[model samples]
Target: MTEFDLIVFGGGTGNRVASAAAEAGMETALIEKGPIGGLCLNRGCNPSKMLIQHATVANRVREASRFGIDASIDDVHFRGFVREVNDELAAVADRKAQDKRDQVNLTLFQEEARFVDDRTIELVESGETHTGEEVVVASGSTPVVPDSIDGIDEVDFLTSADALRLETSPERLVVLGGGYIAAELGYYFDAFGTDVALIDRNETLLHREDADVARAFTEVAEERHDVYTGHSATAVDESNGEFVVTAETEEGGSVEVTGDELLVVLGRRPNTDGVGLDATNIETDDRGFVATDDRLRTSVDGVWAMGDVAGNAMFKHTGDYEGEIVVDNVVHDAGREVDFTALPHAVFTEPQVAAVGRTEAELDKSGTEYVVGRAAFTDTAMSRALKLDRGFVKVLCDLESRAVVGCHVFGHEASILVHEAVPAVRYGLTVDDLANTLLHAHPALSKLVQKACADAVDAADRTTE
Candidate 1:
C-alpha cells in the first residue's frame, strides 16, 4: 500500500486539481489510463477543432467563387492532414505528461484507478493500493453506444472519438444523432467532399439549442448533407463492404441509408461506472454520474467529483470551471460554491453556433417572465461587406428587471462572438446596460451582438408600454 496526501482519478480537468494540490505542497498522485490531457486533448475538442479548421479552409476555398476569388481546393491530402494534427496533439500530451512527472510533489500514474473503499484506491493492473486523505474523481465521460440497435454488435461503426482521427474520408458517411457532435462531424466530412447523410430521431439538428437556432441549423445542414430528421435508426447491416442503416421515419415508414462508413454521436455517459464507484460508499445518480454538492464534494468525506462525472455540464470549459472550485475548496480550504452562471457552449459546425445562459424554452418552462430580441447578421454593415447569407442573434432578458438572461448566435465566428454576452449574462447586466455602455468597433462582427442588445432594449420597452 502506498499512501498519498491526495489521489486524483482522471487526468482531464482533474489534472488541474491535482496540479494545484501538488503546487500547494501536498503530495499528489494523478492516475490516468491514457493520455495526460484526457478527452479534450486526445479525442474531443482540441483535435476535433484542429481537424475542422482544415475543413473550414476547404469550405472557404470551395465557396471562394462567390467572393470572386476563383480559389479552388486542388487536393485535400486528407490522410496526411489528419496525421499531422494527431501527431501534434500526441506531442502536446507527451509534454503534459513530462511536466507532471517533473513536479516534485506530484506522481503520474499512467494506469486505470478504481475505488477500494471510502478513502482508498487501487491501480487495476498493478494491484497497488493507495490511500488518500482526499480524493477527486474527474474521470470525465465516454461516448454512449446504444445496445438497442439490432446487429449493432456485429457491425463496425465509428464513435465521435473515432471520427476525429479518421484518416481517409469515406466516400459516403452515415451519421447517427443530431446534436453538436453529429453536426460538427457531419459538416467536416461533407466539406471534405464526402457524401454525408445525417439521420436523427430529433425533428431538427442541435435539438437542444434554442428552437429558432435549431430550425436554422437544420436548414443549413440540409443544404449540405442528406438530412433525415425525425428518423430513428433501427438497425445496422453491412454487405459488400458498405453499411446499410435502416431507420423508422416519424410518419411510420421505413427508410434505408447506405454509406461507406457509419458514425454514431448519440451522446455521452459519465465514466463513473468505470472507476469502481460501486465498491465505495460514493453515491452516483441514476444516470451513473457521481453526485456532488455545490462545493463539488461527493457524499463520502474527503472525496470530490467534478467534470463529466459530476454531470453539471459536459463541455471542457465547464469541467475546467468545476476543477477550479474543487482546487480552491480542497487545497486552500476555501468554501467556494460552484458558480455556473452564464455558462456557455459552442458548436464548431460551419456557420457555427454559440449560446450563453438559459434558452427561452427553459425560461418559459420555469414560468419566468422574459422578453426576446432578435437581429440578423445582415442588419450589420460588416455582414453585408463580408457577403454572409445566414447569421442571427437572439437576446433574452427578464421582463421586469431587464437583466440579460440568455443569448444565442448562429453564424461565422459565433463561438467568439458569443463571449461578449457572457459578461452581461454572468453579471446580470440589463439590456440597456450592455447596449448603451459597450463600444463596438465599426464593421466588426461583434456589432451583431450590439444590434441584438439594442433590439432587446426596444422589445423590453415595448413590453412595458
Candidate 2:
C-alpha cells in the first residue's frame, strides 16, 4: 500500500484542490480516470458554450437584415467546428497533465479510484491500495439516462455528451428536456439549420427559472421550434432511420414527435455509483448527492467531498468556489464557510436568460415582503438601436432591508449584464443604493438595469394603505 498526505478523487475541478495542497508543501495524490479537466472542460460547459457561440454568430449574420444591414451565412462546416473544439480541448487536457508532471509534490494516478476503507482507495486496474491523511472525493456528476423509458435497447439515442460531439446536424432533432441544457443545445443546433422539436413534461421551458421568465422564453422559443409542453414521453421507437417519441399530455391526448435523432437531457446524477461509499460513512442524500456541511465536510473523519457530488450548486464556477472553500479548510486549516447568497446562472438560448438570488416565486413561497421592478427591452431606448424586439429585466427587493434580493434578465447578453445585478444582491445593495451611486451610460444595455433599479426604488416607496 502506498500513501500520501492528501488524496483527491475525481479529475475535474478536484485538480484545483490538489494544486492547493501541493502548493502548501503537502504530498498530494490525484486519482483520475483519463481526462484531467473534468466535465466542464471536456464535455459539459466550456465546449458547449464554444459551439453555442458559433451558432450565435451564424444566426446573427443570417438575421442581420433586421438591423437594416444585408448579411447572410451561405455555408457552415459544422463537423469541422466540432472537431476543432475537440482538438483544442485535447490540447488543454495535455497542458493540464504537463502541469501535473511539473509539480514535484503531487502524484497523478491515471486510473479509477474506489473506496476500500474510510481512509483507503484502491485503483480499479492494478488493485493498488493507497491511504491518505485526508481524502477528498471530488468525483463530479454524469448525465442520467433513466430506465423507465422503453425501446432503449432497440435504437440509438444521444445524450448531451453524444450530441455535443455530433459532426453533422441532422435534418430534424427531437429534444427530450426543457431545462437549460435542452434550451442551449437545441438553440445551437436549430441555429445551424436543424429543424429542432422540444418536448417537456413541464408546461413551461426552463422550469427552474422564474415563471414569468420561463413563459416568456417558451413563447419566443415556440416561434422557432415545435414545442410540446405538459407532455410526458412514454415510448421511444425507431423506424426508417428516424426516432418517434410518443408523449402523453395531461390534457388526455398522445402526441408523436419524429426526428432523425433524439437528444435526452433530462437531468444529471452524481457519480457515486460503484465508488464503494458503503465502506465509509459518507452519507448521501435521498437523491444520492454527498452530504456536506457549510465547511464541505463529510460524516467520516479525514474525508471531505465537494463540487457536484456535494450538490451545493452544479455549475463549474460553483465547483471552483467550493474547491476554494475546501482548500481553506483542508490545506490552510482555516474554518472558512461557503456563502452562495448571489450565485448566478445563465441559459444562452435566444432571448437569453440570467438570474441571481431568489425568484419571485421563491419570495412569495417564503412569505417575504418584496416588490418587483421590471423593464422590457422593447420599451427601452437601446432596443431600437440594436434592433432587439424582445427581452426584459426583473428585480426583486425586500421591504425591510430595501436590498436587491433577486435579479433576473431575459435579453441580449443577459449573462454578462447579470453581473451588474450580482453585486446588488451579493452585497445587499438597496435600490436606493444602486440608484444614488451608479449612473448608466446613455443608449446602452446597462440603461435597462438602471431603469429597473430606479423602478424598484419608486415601487418600494409607494403607500399601499
Q: Please provide, for model 1 over 54-113, each residue's C-alpha lDDT reduced to its tens digit, 9 standing for 90 to 100.
A: 888888787888878888666779999899999999999999999999998999999877
- State model 1's lDDT: 0.91
Instruction: Kindly report which residue stretches of model 1 are placed more than 4 angstroms away from their true locations once superposed.
Output: none
List TM-scores for all candidates, in order.
0.98, 0.97
Candidate 2 RMSD to the real structure: 1.3
lDDT of 2: 0.89
lDDT, residue 125, candidate 2:
94
In TM-score terms, candidate 1 sits at: 0.98
Best by TM-score: 1
Clashes of each: 0, 1
